[model samples]
Target: MTGRLSMGSGQPIKLAERRVFSDSFKPLYNEGMSLVERAAEYLDGPGRVEARKLSRMAATLYAAESMRLTTRLMQIASWLLLQRAANSGEMTRDQVASEKSKVRLDTASAPDNAIGWNELPEAFLALVNNSLSLQNLVRLMDEEIYGRNAGMTDMPPPRRSNPVSDQISLLNTAFARG
Candidate 1:
């Protein structure tokens, strides 16, 4: 079955709240299986087998990353709340707010435009909050894809380190070759 690509509206989209199950995780399952199958078709004998093995490896990595991203999202949510508290001069302000304002994860718009947990400052409190966000995201994704505990096996996309890092690296490589 084919599925539609969804965009976040402005409100938050909690897949966990929706109670999506393993059956919902069909998209990812198909993707994982397809990667392995395609690798098998393109690779011959040992190479084909290796391709399949790599596919599985990629799937595993994706799952782990998905879990991590979920945790980070939760952390970000908590951090946002905490900031609100601190802004109001709470008794204990454990986390420091960013010098600049941060955009919250509002499903009311788009995931691509959403500020990710990783976008938070790389500091102690930020890291803690980021982790929480990741955990939450994974929980939600799992529930959304496969109801209950099924989402636990979700394979997510690779975690690209620092958004600017990739750009900088590409530029450096280009200049070095010149």
Candidate 2:
């Protein structure tokens, strides 16, 4: 989970094929849930107070950023829950992966210099930063556990037919051979 998995001889396994059933996944789940709870408590308590003191533009930006933060956390929480379900045997890997596909990992915060961004409390900012870090970790793990893709390169390409073009090409090949 640190970065690589290895065989008994220590040659690294392919990352895309890595599985999430290891004990290592538990720490990630704990950290993710902890962050989600902390973010929620802060937003509902001190964060509300902090937002009230911001200037008009900063307050507006704060509202928007808060929405983004909440949405991001929800997505992270969903992914963590699914991963836990898979780890706990509550759900099969295939079911978890299917549900995981619906969880979005692309949410991002505003630029540091965005309007009123500097006015946000440092604690709130820290939460945002931490959540982003967790999101990235989850995304990497998802790819590793699920295989980066379906490994479809071996499948035959889709056929495209143009009867006239095929006939002309056939004629060309025959004549050229002669």
C-alpha RMSD values across all candidates: 17.5, 17.0
lDDT accuracy of residue 33 in candidate 1: 39
What would the C-alpha RMSD of candidate 1 be, to one decimal place? Answer: 17.5
Off by over 4 Å in 1: 1-54, 89-178
Q: Which 10 consecutive residues of model 2 have the lowest summed lDDT?
A: 151-160
TM-score between model 1 and native: 0.23
Query: Which prediction has the highest lDDT against the true structure?
Result: 2
lDDT of 2 by residue, 11-78 (tens): 87755324457677677778888998999999999999988998876776677667778988898899
Candidate 2 lDDT (Cα, 0 to 1)? 0.71
Prediction-by-prediction clash tally:
44, 0
| Per-residue lDDT of model 1, residues 1-178, tens digit only | 1122446766544543232222444443343334334333433344324324334333333223333444444333443344344445552322333311232332111122222323322332232333444444544443343345441233343344454653443344435432
